[model samples]
Target: MLPPIYTWLKASNAVKAIIGNTPRAYRPGDAPQDVTQPYVTWALVAGVPDNQLSSTPPSDRYTVQVDCWHTTDKGVEDLAKAVRNAIEPNAHLTAIPVNNRDPETKLYRIALQFDVLQTR
Candidate 1:
């Protein structure tokens, strides 16, 4: 079974509007060099399957982390709020957003996570 986060983000009008000309948000390891300035990146931090019955396919619960980054805090905050609003609309996800500046790059970012459960 496939997780819905990828499809959801790809189809989200809110996210699309906020990202502007940026490319599709990508997983951490796959981000390209041009993935910069007012962009988003995310990864499924961890996942586990549950509720197996007599060797049946197990349900899945995943922790996904999303990062919104920009040279200034304005864009980061806007993008973060957009992402939160978009994800929160889905009743299944519980979203927590936190903000901090990256010490090295000096970029402002909002880091958030979604707790997702998938049962098949």
Candidate 2:
């Protein structure tokens, strides 16, 4: 997992205000058995973060796959939408939301990819 993504999520008032520091699983293959509902789990889907070549590489660019899980589809979609809104800290940075389901666990999942460019 990219540390910047983690840091952004951790420090995001938008996210915290919505979820209130709920459990965030870094690159988790499976949600923890004891973890509460409407939580977050993420995984590294591709390459490491690349440098944003803005004259002096002042920022890094990367994609983080964020998954929102909940018992109900409504809950999953709502949480996912909140995640999408929360992660958008900048105009150039955005998250694409997709509806999905975990193949193994068969839980409702709101999959999102946050395309980010953060200052170094």
Best by lDDT: 1
The C-alpha stretches of model 2 lying farther than 4 A from their native spots are: 1-3, 10-22, 29-31, 46-56, 91-98
Task: TM-score for candidate 2, please give it.
Answer: 0.66
Q: How far is candidate 2 from the true structure (C-alpha RMSD, Å)?
A: 4.0
TM-score of 1: 0.79
Candidate 2 lDDT over residue span 1-120, tens digit each:
353555656666656554567436455756567766657777655544454556655556666688777777877777776666666664233455667777776678877876656566
* Candidate lDDT (C-alpha), each: 0.72, 0.64
Clashes in candidate 1: how many?
A: 0
User: Which pairs clash in the backbone of model 1?
Assistant: none
Which ranges in model 1 have alpha carbons more than 4 Å from their true place?
A: 21-23, 91-98
Score every model by TM-score.
0.79, 0.66
